[model samples]
Target: MKVNKKMKTSALAGAALLSLQALPASADQEYLLTITRPGHLQVIDMSTNEVVRTCDVPGKFGTGSIAPSPDGKIAYVLSNMTEDVYGFDIQTCDITFHAAQSQGNVRVKTHQSITVSADGKELYTVQNPVRHLPDRFEVMEPQLAVYNTADGTDAKPVRTFPVDRRITKIAATEKGEVILGGADIKAIDVNSGEVRMVTALQSWDRGPEWLPPDAFAMHSQGEQSNEYIMPYVTAKFQDDTMNMETAEWWWGISRVDLATGEAVRQEIIPFEFIVFNFISDPRDPNIFYGSFNTLSKHDITTGETLALYEMPHTYYDLNISADGKTIYVGGTSSDISIHSSDTLEKIGSIQLSGDMSTSDLRVATIRD
Candidate 1:
């Protein structure tokens, strides 16, 4: 059975409406962000830096990935639990409709990551079994599903691509290119619909849910003007090392050569445990930014570490405002952190209703 998940305004507070008369024009712009914690979606004001509102995402209907359509008219919330997608109107704060269902008998599992194309017409989601047997390490292979959004109805899955091993995380590039990062880094060809194995990580590896409490909580906070690098580490033993042990886990931002399935660049970052959830620059495709246990930025084009900032709280995910001038950081921290993209400064921060590490944030644009 399909269920609906919605948030109410009573749970939110309006922006403080403070004036920035002396500040630049860009400083006055505001952004509305939604984050998941337990059963609630905490809404934050990018300008005021406060938890102005809170909405309840139904407990049974878990929210996986959150994205806003191009024109900023509608937001898409993917629920792996219900095996469905919900569309919300930004201005009205209402559930408009559900995404078109997977077409031609294609099905989706719970907890899969979702992404929308740059043009905003296509929706890509990855599905993996929610539960797996522990006895045999037969990982749940992931399948990539695609959907069309024009009809404003249930999207039918157009493609079903598979992965060799279990996937830990997934991301999309500016040109609508898909890169899957985790224990192994892989890429998918959106045009040709081809999936290829790019590279296998040999260091710092771990299964899901390995992050410590402090790093996990700090990762939920997303402020501070700096870049970050985390070291990848895993257990070491004589027997484990002799048999090609699975000691290394992959973390941090990875740079890839899309034209050729090559993970041309990568770096081991600090914080042994923390899953990353954040956004990359659309304007500067090579400039990647993210936060988990810490905050960081990197330029793939120049192979340089731009900056790394340490956060007092853990940030689970990050989203950029429509213009990329503002950033909304969500996580378990008591406050919602906002940053200046240009100066990389923490301009404002507000307390939210729930802990950080909510859902993945997606920005979509609608254009005819």
Candidate 2:
């Protein structure tokens, strides 16, 4: 009986120790990976804001975007210049999924169009038609290609479906619908290949004076937004006498909920201020941070601006932390400009050692 009691105590102690080991580490120990042009990637420690590791990748250009795995173990980078999709393992520093061509050896390319399914089993990329002649390009039907992420390198699209051209960015909803970002937002049914126009900036019930512009540019649009994602655009009202060349444009943000398909559009600034991407803080939904030439923090609840400031240089990409602590800015330089979420002050920077151009800043939680 004494021996049985001792065995029970030993098992309890072992279970207690195992529970301690299973506890998650503090968020302070997290890491972030920032990619730069001319083929370089820097993984930085978020706690210390210091470089932890670096890797050089070949066949990279400035026109590519990365989609990180949900577990943050891998990053799928789509490059238009190389016409290839590469899966980069952040932990092991191994590169796989080197798909350079589509069906029938046809060279395919993408421009800031990539996303991975929630389960991390499928990868999606937009394949744009190639330019056949100078000043004139061929008009092959644009398509969305879906590949099995686990297949790696030589993976081909298990299915290809028609998609409209002029799609600048890509994101997915929980229901497997693809959100196509452009002048107007569209939701494409992946299985049916049906394109539905959910939200057009002009479709909103604004007055007759409101005008939606012809183009919208967002650098870091392929991100994970639990609420929704919106791209900043410039459009304004003009007087009957005002010429199109003379009228100033106003900046605004329009977002559509993936769950309900409801959209909301509101003007942030009344003048022509450039904004690349305007993403909100989930911790505080009213507060949003974005960039164009300046890193700005604004509150949608209050008409008053929160904070707007210049950076070390111009940047196009900006992402607010999940906890709303830091704003990671990239897309134009070799540094990930880190700033305080409240004060908008320049605190620290992740500077690279060489001449590089950074694009698309994303913060992922690395899972064990």
Q: What's the number of clashes in each of the models?
A: 54, 3
lDDT of candidate 1 at residue 162, scale 0 to 100? 71
Top lDDT prediction, candidate number: 2
Candidate 2 ranges beyond 4 A from true positions: 1-30, 80-82, 102-105, 131-137, 202-208, 221-224, 232-239, 242-249, 258-262, 355-358
- In order, what lDDT does every prediction score? 0.51, 0.69
- The residue ranges of model 1 lying beyond 4 angstroms of the native Cα positions read 1-32, 38-45, 50-64, 80-82, 97-107, 110-112, 129-141, 173-177, 199-252, 256-263, 268-313, 318-328, 339-347, 361-368
RMSD of each: 13.7, 4.5
TM-score, candidate 1, is 0.58
lDDT of 2 by residue, 47-111 (tens): 67787777666575646477777677777776537377788877666886767754453446677
TM per prediction? 0.58, 0.83
The most accurate candidate by TM-score is: 2
Error of 2 at 261 (Å): 5.2
